[model samples]
Every structure is written in C-alpha cells, then in structure tokens.
Target: MMELAVVWSVLIAQTMLALAMAFALYRMARGPRAQDRILGLDTLYINAMLMLITFGIRTANTVYFETALIIAVIGFASSIALAKFLMRGEVIE
Candidate 1:
C-alpha cells in the first residue's frame, strides 16, 4: 500500500516536472529580453534536476542522483557566467 503510493507520487511528480520544463522552454524561447530568457533557463535547470531526483526515487538508482548533481553544478555555473556576460559583455576578465 505505501509502496503503491510512493510509486504514484513519483509518477505524478515527474509529470508535473515535465510540464514545467516545457513551459520554461517556451518562456526561454519566446522571452523578449535576455534577463527573461535567463530566468527561464534557470527555471528549466531546476525542473530538470528535480525530474532526475524523481527518477532516482522511482527506480532506486544512484546514477540518476549523481547525474542530477552534475546538472546542478553545471547549470549554476552556466547561469552565473551568462549573467556576468550580460552585465559586462564577457564571461572572464
């Protein structure tokens, strides 16, 4: 009974995350300003990480968790770089 609930919850979470990702993608593509697009990209990365976490929970796999961690690190760095570039017109000094 509890296992069934867990399975259903994970499925629902993944579905929601996927929908959110789609919306984020649309925003990133359609945004008129660079900042808006960057915000959308940030949201996308967060949703993607959560989706991977849900997959790890559903499958009892560590790989998905590790991959999510990698995505987190890379996403954070990239977002920072993008923001800095937008502000200064370059990523590095």
Candidate 2:
C-alpha cells in the first residue's frame, strides 16, 4: 500500500511538472519583453530539473539524480549569461 501511494504521488508530481513546463513554454514564445521570455525559459529548465529529480526518486536510481544536477548547473549558467546580456548587451567581458 505504501508503494502504491508513492507511485501515485510520483505520477501526480510528474503530471504537474509537465503542465508547468507547457505554461512556461507558452510564456517563452509569447512574452512581450525579453525579460519575461528569459524568466519563462528559466522556469522551464527548473521544472525540467525537478521532474528529473522526481523520476530519480521514483526509480530509486542515481543516474536520474546526476542528470538533474547537470541540468541545474546548466540552467544556472544560462540564466546568468542571459542576465548579463540583458544588462550589458553581452555575456562576456
């Protein structure tokens, strides 16, 4: 019964994450300003990472966790680059 409950919870979490990603995508595509689009992209990546972590938990696997960590690192870097570009018109000095 506990296992069944865990499975159902994971399923529900994944479904919600998918819905969040879809909304983020819509914002990314339709945002009127660059900042809004960047925010949407950031949200999308964060949700993807969370979904991966949930998958890892559901499967009791380290591989999914590692992948999620990588995604988080990449997302953080990209968000920084984007913010720098927005402020200075370039990512690197």
Candidate 3:
C-alpha cells in the first residue's frame, strides 16, 4: 500500500540522517581549525532539520515541522555570528 511505502521511506531517511549526524559530530569534535568545526556544525544543523522533517512526515504531525523551522532559523543566525566572530574576533561591532 501507499501508506506502507511512505512509512518505509521515512524510516530509511531517518536512518540516513542519523548516520550523517554522527559524522558531523565527529567533524565538529575533532576539526583542526575553527572553520572546519563551523562547517561541521552547519552540516549537523541541516541534518537535524531534515530529521525533524522526516519525523513530521512519518507522524503526520505539524509540530515537528514547526520545530524544524525554528531550528533552521536559529542555525542560520548562529552560523552567521560564528563566521563574523572568526573573521573579526567579535560578533558585533
């Protein structure tokens, strides 16, 4: 059935996102430089957002989608701040 296919696909997507998150964590932890670590954090947030999206699809819930949106907004703002800090040694002028 279509429902079964949807469930299975969402399960697979979630599994992949989990694996990606693991890799991102490793990169963030062991990165030799600030830029590499920042890149890892960026990837981690994106995977987290996608994981939430897959959960929303699986559960047919709107809350997961809204939470994912919040994560995305916060992640983007944090990444910009980090980049600015790395470049100028200050987040704000």
Question: How do the predictions measure up, each by TM-score?
Answer: 0.95, 0.95, 0.95
**Clashes in candidate 2: how many?**
0
Candidate 2 on 58-81: residue-level lDDT in tens? 999999999999999999999999
Model 2, runs deviating above 4 Å:
none
What is residue 10's positional error in candidate 3, in angstroms?
1.0
Q: Which parts of model 1 are misplaced by more than 4 Å? A: none
Ranked by lDDT, top first: 3, 2, 1
Q: Taking the tens digit of each residue's C-alpha lDDT, what string does model 3 give over 1-93?
A: 999999999998889999999999999999989999999999999999999999998888999999999999999999999999999999999
Over 4 Å off, model 3 = none
